[model samples]
Target: MRHLTQNWHVNILGFVLFLFTAVLLLIADNLSISYKEALTFYDEKNLLHYLSNLSVYFLGQSNIALRFPFILFYVLSVILMYKMTADYFKYESDRLISVLIFMFLPGIIGASLLVNNSIIVIFCTILYLYYYRTYNRHNYVLLFIFVFLDNSFAILFLALFFYAMKNRQNQLFIISLILFGLSMYIFGFDTFGKPKSHILDTFAIYASIFSPLLFLYFFYSMYRIGVKGKRSIYWYVSMTAFLFSFLLSFRQKIYIEDFAPFVVVTVPLMMKLFFHSLRVRLPRFRDKHYKVAALTLFLLFVNVGVILFNKPIYLMLKQSDDHFAYNYHFADEIAQLLQKSNIYTVTSNDYKLLKRLEFYGIHTDKKSTNFISIKPLNVYDKKFQIDYFNTNILNIYYVNLKK
Candidate 1:
């Protein structure tokens, strides 16, 4: 019975976390088609188009099919993180704090519920942390697979991991670098000079600039890791390489998942200090500090509460007034037109209608999936005719087939 209680308590934490995350994600999924619409309008539509037409040789499933797998990966990541935190700290209180902090992480919370590359980032980060804790090289292989499955910018985690390994295993690090290069080319990025003007721009720029100054703090913490004696050159070089990588990724939308490895490394380095400071002072004025800490935690949760909860609240209220006015009208008109038609090709400059239909699960024949430009409307291609359209930007239409 005692052993059962212990195991129950142990597994229950992760179970609760997964359940909480699943609930939050469902809320996001149910709110509206806005988020998915944006995904289809921007980049996912191209990926989906590619997936639908993929060669027989490919092993991956379709775009929509990847969503649940991605969610499961994210759930596994948080569970792994909680275990790593618990194992590292040893103290139940500290472990609890770590779990709560991770749950409320502005970046983690924001990304976990969304069906995008951010979830990949979360999984990679947690996986790296777990690897660091276990000193397992096999985890690196998993990292490689996820990096391949994810988009190009996701390679940043691989770069950071290799940077950490370069000191002890030079050959392994070099191999990883080569693999990354090959992965980039194989995954569809042009390896030639200045391949794409906007390629990895978000990870290479914007996200890099936002890294916490804690990175510099981590550098000092490395001294405590005793890295200066035998591997001083490797340590310093690795730090410089990672810093440079971060600098290069400044403008890129690298997202928090890319930085997960870096974040996990700091746990061991900083946990002692966090605890020592708390122990020394926490005993002197218990109630006062407790109150202050509680308030701070509340504020942090509230800040995230706004992003995770309030946004949907506002969206739901706003949606009530026009719940069926625009989308239903548009869908009804189009569904009626194509109810019996054998059209297959669709060409439209406007992504909104196309994306909304896709979001609403309205599958149809082959879609051209091209962006309409303000310059001209090209509806008269050999493959498709202007069965439906808006003159303003060629909003929506159908070709002659079925999906």
Candidate 2:
């Protein structure tokens, strides 16, 4: 009966993951190409761009095509999160909570649909953790292998070096130290334009990334580990990145990506600390801990809902640009609208917008007669609807100069 019950729990976990992936596909279908995505798709030749090009080539250029790889990264990250939880957390319930929280994290959800390296970075970092803990001797092989993967891995190497030093794992220390130096040499840190302080902005971004309530507990979890709890390799990695990112924020605005991936995998750590706290207390005193957990989960679920149903957020915004996802709108819709008119060739004043349109069968021909211009008209275009309500996202004009 016990074995059967364990299998039932495993089935529940598998079903939940399937549902999550389905939700991810739905969100990706709704997303339009952003200006940053335009830059990534057309200008850059990084790993992500190369994979995206391949996807779009095989699948045709659609939002789902552009985003499918990132969503796959999301799936891998979720599975790895579960694996990490299985290691760090003893109980089935604790492991389940950790995986669910990670899947619902606002940052993770957004990264999965956008043209960014965050999801992949998260996937790689967690994979490294699973390897580091599971395989003792061969771990540094992966450690050294990561030097060429990403500039962000420099932060990972730094954290690993610190962990090695603390635990006196000489092999891990030397390899991570060498890898850290190599990564810095190849992808030098760019702290330029970071002279100004944006500590408050950094805090706000983190809050939004994890949701305000969960981030609060994440911070507390780190402090709790430092003050009293026994720390593990994962804790060391997470704490190092958390401190480094914030320390840099005191000087200049830090790229949250460099640090966030390292810290997010610590959701298991945060859950472990939470459950430990609740269980250690007397039953009567545990009410506060339960309340905190309930509130945090509520916020996390709300954050996920807001992201999945973000089209409706346009209705609340005074200016379309003021909307949080404003960057990912306009281009695909406008391209489709123009293609219907058999207008395949045009030049836009917005260079980025023009490039994005190219992905959807529109091409830029400079010195051509057709000119595309945009204005901030609040009138809804009957052509482009986000869900059932059409958005007045942009007013585009196609000026014809044919004599």
Candidate 3:
């Protein structure tokens, strides 16, 4: 009874801490539209139109409702992450260390706070890994269903990699072949249709830059343990993936939610093995002080690096206007202008603007002229919506209402 009471107290405390973190994160700037917008843009577009529609269903067409569903998903993801850390590193000490590592990691924390696709990817990846580690079976099939939510070829590839990790060779091979075919079709590779650029070229470029490094690291770690047939396969998969990402990363807009998990899981395992090697040669390399110093230095460098790279980007993005609000303001101004102008369909090269306007319940069939910039505008042609503050755009400016 006493132990149960203590456990309850601990659990309650944990929940309180979790809620505090989540609430602060939830309040951060909402620069991007939730997955709800993407679905609404492409699909039948009912029940899931705005973030508010997730909780309190206000049937009014003004595009506002309760936001609890999105908030709930974010909170649930953080709680599951806590549970995963507790399970994977079962020892009390290890669990504490793992949780600290997760809390400090820029990618993990930044994704948790946003309504972006990355959080969905994080949830799916964590759940899949947890189930795989726990059941050691094709339990990943259950997890793969959620992967479609992320729209990432890299994640689909990672899912196939997970399937291949099992001892069942026949099952792994069949799954891999299916994934290969599916990837080709969905990603605009060969056979599905011709992409603007060759998929093989992208694969080759990423592979050349990152694969050799990943392979060398994998080989060095594995060689220490006598690399045999099945164990060696892991490196091959890692390299193949690294190659795919090298091309994908160049696009700059590709979200990390798509591939961060692969690095998070794989890197830790590699480091663990590296540390094990260091331990074996501890006496020759250094005494206790040196070993501690090395580990501390390595961790410090990683912590600093993660912060330097991730925080500024997340902050800048978080400070921007939420996609819905930005478009909403723009549309209201346009609607006022439309009252005076005879124009209806605006030709816009900006895909995001088109999507954003649609998300805010503004109707326009943004047609684009062949010229990328400044072509003759017909009096019948509609005005192109432009945000005045965004500096990259020079030729476009918002004509004020008084004018």
Ranked candidates (TM-score, high to low): 2, 1, 3
In candidate 1, where is summed lDDT lowest over 10 consecutive residues? 385-394
Q: Of models 1 and 2, which has the larger TM-score?
A: 2
Ranking by lDDT: 2, 1, 3
Q: Please, what are the lDDT tens digits per residue for candidate 2 over residues 221-261?
A: 99988889888878888889888888898888778888888
* TM-score against native, each model: 0.56, 0.93, 0.52
In model 3, how large is the Cα lDDT of residue 50? Answer: 46
TM-score of 1: 0.56
State the weakest 10-residue window (summed lDDT) of model 2. Answer: 379-388
Candidate 3 versus truth, CA RMSD in Å, comes to 9.0
Stretches of model 3 off by over 4 angstroms after superposition: 1-20, 23-26, 29-75, 81-90, 113-115, 143-168, 186-240, 247-257, 267-403
Top candidate when judged by TM-score against the true structure: 2
What does each candidate score in C-alpha RMSD? 9.6, 2.7, 9.0
- In each prediction, how many residue pairs overlap at the backbone (N, C-alpha, C within less than 3 A)? 25, 0, 3
Pairs in steric clash, model 3: 52-66, 206-243, 207-243
lDDT tens digits, residue span 35-96, model 1? 35345434554543343224212533223332444455556766776666656565666766
Off by over 4 Å in 1: 4-12, 34-68, 138-140, 151-166, 184-246, 249-272, 280-282, 285-295, 311-350, 361-403
